[model samples]
Target: MFYGVSALGRKWSNRSPEEHVRRWGRIAYGVSILGFASHVTFFITRWIGGGHIPTSNMYEFMTFLAMAIMFAFIVVNAIYRKPLLGLFTLPLTVIIVAYAAVFPQEVQPLIPALQSIWLKVHVTTAATGEAFFAVGFAAGLMYLLRTVDFKKTSPQARREQRWVEFTLFVIVVIIAFIGSVFSFRGAGYEATFKQENVVIDDKGIESTTTETVEYSLPPIFKPFNSQDVLVEPFLGVKKPLMETPSWMKGVNAARKLNTITWSIINGAILYGLLRLVLRKRIGAAIHPLMDGIDEDDIDEISYRAIAIGYPIFMLGALIFAMIWAYIAWSRFWGWDPKEVWALITWLYYTAYLHLRLSRGWHGSKSAWLAVIGFVVVMFTLIGVNLVLVGLHSYAGV
Candidate 1:
């Protein structure tokens, strides 16, 4: 709604309508504030219900990310008074919130590894830092769209530009796919599978037992020992086209693969629809909206956001995370996928800072770095947890 109102406000501004644009803009801002407040209330409520801070799982972390994005946006807008910032930032927040909503929302008890007090401190601070990074992503994207000279680009450059825009469109489609899956869950979609496990006893006697497991989403691939007997009749395909390898350790590995497959399929469909409607790349479609905004201001906001976010991210994601790991696992670094990715994120941003400050990389170069930095952040936060199996896999819940 905030995004729609902002767009409406922009459209009305062209006709010099009677205060409607400004009124809608203020209302949109108010809605975002309300969203922040609602997130706060939800966090407190979950904290009270679960008897811990609400950053222990994907649902909680994503909600925190949404809150942090709004908080950062409100602060940035207050300083810059750039209503366009809201237009870019809020959509990203909505995507985060929507993706978060796809996860199970039921609050569960924290696992043993997550019971430490540092869980709250470490995770919340990291999320706050990444939230600011998200702001940088929005600003950097706006800067690129505003300043890039697409019309004068070479043929090869235009092809590369289309690919970049398609990638962004794919990201949006992935979010929408998650949202659609969540909706399907609400509509009683489920897939059930039967598996037979062969067990060897101490006496060398072998026994086989069969068990049935149900999944919220269709499994695109069945486990080696399992057969999907029933699947919700949706998406025109009932059974997975492939079998999950036995080497995949997780019980839900097949389901995860299925979800990824479906997301790609759905995303492709949405991308086609977007292309058909716009008759141009998504980035090109959005370029006109940045007409009046100053590229330098956008560039500086991106840089300043990174400047502010880097230290916080380092302190929380790296320092605090390492300390917590030591206390919990009695090790400084265990090469857990999450920990390694966190380190990679830190190093990436560190490199971004060095390039900007020392090499005088500014404008498009800096902005592109900021944009890529957020991609790393997202992978560390979402991709690592979802796609990779490691000590932090519990957080995917």
Candidate 2:
């Protein structure tokens, strides 16, 4: 709040020197410093209490990522002196922290595979590198909002406007999704399914077992070949709309799908309400505040942050990841979903840099790439864990 107010005040001060908002800006920076200190303290205490670095699971990893983002934001803001950077960066931090809460918070003993220093090093370093990419994302998105023309109804401008609006909508979906999860959880909503699977051994012996899955959200999709052991009705709906496809090979696929469904439904409804009230595209609504902002500085921030992050990402996500994988699984790469996606993310930024430097992709084109690159990063981070069962499956909810 202080950062936001101070940024706005700084804007006002720029327009009218009589406002004298320097005092407020200093106070905001001080509070931000204090907040970062507290965040680090939490990390230290959690590490000490857990007897392991807290990057073992979704909750711990996301919190650590959020802290890294703040750390990056502080560094960038110090260098750039842009209070408005916090307007984008801090909200992203809050959203990530809130999204982390959607997962179970219980602390569990580390599995043997995770009991390695390499595992800790790989996760932390990778998250730190991704944090810089996230800062780049924030700046890139701000650049779009600042430069995209809200009033030009020409075809190209209209296309840009729609994509920008879509990006904002995705953010809303995340927020609404979190709200939906906690809302149902707080109301004690519960449903369970029983899935049966048959496994054949080397001796040609077949064994069947039933696996149970639970859902806090209404089950829009249930497990394949599963029966409702118990279902708590929501809004008069007692059964799932459909079953998860058999091709989806994850134990948690159904629950994850249902959660996504709720997020979209909730997001659409909330977005609709907001659109009606604002009576404009969300990006258009926001574009006015960015009127006097410099797009070039934002572009530079986006590029520099990504430039710094790419090699770190290469080091941690790929190099250290391969080392850890070799140590744990006796192979550097087995084409695990997580590993594949991390490579995809790295390739994406590689292309972004290539286009920016070699092919002359600049300004809005570069910004768009930066924005989409983070989406790839997010899928590599959260989406893979949620939708794909892999060696890193235990790292997720």
Best by lDDT: 2
Instruction: Estimate the TM-score of every prediction.
Output: 0.89, 0.93
Tens digit of lDDT per residue, candidate 2, span 9-126? Answer: 6455655522434556567777778889999999999889989888888998999999999888888878887667788888999999998988777776789999999877788778
Off by over 4 Å in 1: 2-11, 14-27, 150-153, 196-213, 235-238, 245-249
- Each prediction's Cα RMSD? 3.1, 2.2
lDDT of each: 0.82, 0.88
lDDT of each residue in 289-331, candidate 1, tens digit only: 7776789999989888878888888889989999999999899
Worst 10 residues of 1 by lDDT: 12-21
| Lowest lDDT 10-residue stretch of candidate 2 | 14-23
